[model samples]
Target: MKRNILAFMAVMLMLCMSAQTSQAQLKRFSIGPYVEAGFPTGDFSTTHNPGFGVGLGADVKLIAGLTAVGSVGFDYFKGKTIDNGNTKIASAKVIPVRLGLRYQLISILYVKVEGGTANFTGDYNNGTGALVAPGLGIRLLGLDVEGKYEAWFKDGTHGFFGLKAGYNF
Candidate 1:
C-alpha cells in the first residue's frame, strides 16, 4: 500500500511540472511603447502650454505584484515666455530618465510612484530638475493606461496632470 501511494504521488508531481505554461516566462519582463500628455497647472499653466511626448520602457518583475521599471522619454512643451504672455511659441524639449516601483493592487489595477531627473534642453531652458509623480495604472484591452500628477522642483514652476497609455508585451 505504501509503495502504491508513493508511486501515485511521484506521477502527479511530474504531471504538474509539465503543465506549467508560458505565462511564467512572459511575466518576467514586459516592454512597451508609451504616449503621454501633460496639462500644466498653477504657475506652470501660465508659463507653459500643454505638452505631448512618446517613449518606450520596460518593467522587470521583482516579487509578487511588484515590479521595477526604467524608462527614457522625450517631451515637447510650448513655453510662454516669462517676460509676457507671448503668442510666439518657443519650443522646449525635455528628456527624462526615470526609475520607479509599481505595485499591483488587484487583477487589473496598480499604483506607481517614480522619481528621476529630466534634462530640459532647447529654446526655453530651465536647466535640470528632479521629477516626481504618483500615478494609477489600469490594464485594459492589452494596454496599460495611467493618470498621474507630476511635481517639478524647479526655480519657477508648479506641477502638471499627466495621462499615459501603453501596450505591454
Candidate 2:
C-alpha cells in the first residue's frame, strides 16, 4: 500500500515538472473542499445504503483547457443488514486518493478521468483496491457540481455513482 502511494506521488511529481517545462505559463490553479454522496451499485447496492464523504481537491492548469487534478477523501456507508450471518456488519468506510486530468469542453463544462487506490475498512472488509472514475461537471460562479461512476477492483468489483459539490478558492 505504501509503495503504491509512493509510486502515485512520483508520477504526479513527474507530470507536474514536465508540464512546467513544456508550457509557457499555467492558465489557472485552484484548491477547494467538497462534499459528496455515493450511491452503491451492482451487488454492493444490496448491502449498503447511500454514502457521504468530504474531500479536498486541487487543480493545476497545464494549458488553455487542460488541467491536472487530484483529490483525497473519506466516505462512509451504513449497512442495511444487522449481520451477514457470521459477523456483525454495521457500516463501511473508504479512503480514496486520486489523480487525473480534466479537459474543459467549453467555459463552464468539463470532463475528467481519474484513477487511484482506495482503502476499505469494515466488517469482514479490509484491503486496498484500484479505482477508476470518469466524470463531468459544470463550474458556475466558482462552484462545481459534478457526477461520476467509480469502480474499485480488489477481490471483486465494487461500484458506485457519486455526486459532488464544491467551491473553488
Candidate 3:
C-alpha cells in the first residue's frame, strides 16, 4: 500500500516537472502565494473558531487548458469557548501538502481538485489525515480568486469552506 502511494506520487511529480518544451504559446509554469479565510462546518465549528491560512503553490502546464498543481500551506485555528464560557479547547495548527490538477473551463474560469495529507498539531495532541479539496476559481490578469470546500479525514471527518486570493508569477 505504501509502495503504491509512493509510485503515484512519483508519477505526479514527473508530470509537474516536465514542462520543458519551448513551442507552447502559453506560459509553461507559474508559482504563487495565497492567503485564505476558512469557516469550519458541522461539528468542527462547535470546537473551533474561524481560521486563516497561507500557502505557496506551483503549477506546470501539462497541456492546453490543463495544469498540474502542487502546494504547501499552514492553517491556524483558535479554540472556541465552552462549558458556560469557563473553558476552551486547545488551539490547533495544520500543515498541508497537496498535489492535484486544474482545468480551465473558459477564458478566465477554472475548476480543480486536490488530494494530499494534512498534519495536525494541537496543544495536547497531534496526528495526520487525508485531505481533499474541490474548488472553483477565476484568473484575471495575474490575480486569482477561489472558493473551495476542503475535507480532512482521520478517524472521522472535518471540513471547511474557504475563500482564497492569490497572485501568480
Candidate 4:
C-alpha cells in the first residue's frame, strides 16, 4: 500500500511537470462514462473467476494530441473451483484508478497507454494494489472501443485482458 501510494505520487509529480511544460498547448477537458469487461488469462486456484466492471471517467487534453484520463470503477467476479475438490466461491468489488496518455491519430482515432492501482474489497481478497496497463482506443460514430492488458506486480504478478466500450463527449 505504501509503495503504491509512493508510486502514484511520483507519477502525479511527473504529470504536473509535463502539464506545466505544455500549458500553452493544452486542450479542453472532457468527461464520459465507460463499461469494461476483464478476462483472466492464468490459473485461478484461489481467486474469483473472470469479471465485469463498469464506471465513469474523464479525460483532459494536456498537450497537442496527448490526454490524461482517470476513472473510478467497480468489478464483480464469481469464484471458481480448484484442484483437490476444493471449491472457492467468492465475489469482489474493486476500485481502479487509471491515468493514460492518448495520441490522436486523426479526428476520431487514438492510441493510449495507462497505468494505475486497483483497490479491491469483498468476500475474496482484503488488500489494495497497483497494476500497470497499456491499451488502444478508437472512436466511431460517437462511440469508443478499447482493449487493454493489465499486469499486477505485488506479492505475485499476474496478467489480465480487458475490453471496454463507451461514448466520448
Best by lDDT: 3
Candidate 4 local lDDT, 1-169, one digit each (tens) = 4565456556655655665577636425545678888887665324657788887666667678777776656666667765665765566566677777788888877888877877767755667777787888787755889898876654575567889988755
What local distance difference test score does each model get? 0.75, 0.82, 0.82, 0.69
Which run of 10 residues does model 2 get worst, by summed lDDT? 81-90
- Give stretches of model 1 more than 4 Å off: 1-26, 81-89
TM-score between model 2 and native: 0.81
The model with the greater TM-score, 1 or 4, is: 1
Error of 4 at 138 (Å): 0.1
> Which lDDT tens digits does candidate 2 get at residues 24-104?
374355667899999999877877889998987777887788888888778888877645555445677887889899999
Error of 3 at 107 (Å): 0.5
Candidate 4 deviation (Cα RMSD):
5.2
Model 3 ranges off by over 4 Å: 1-26
Best by TM-score: 3
Residue 145 of model 1, lDDT score = 94
RMSD of each: 14.1, 3.7, 3.8, 5.2
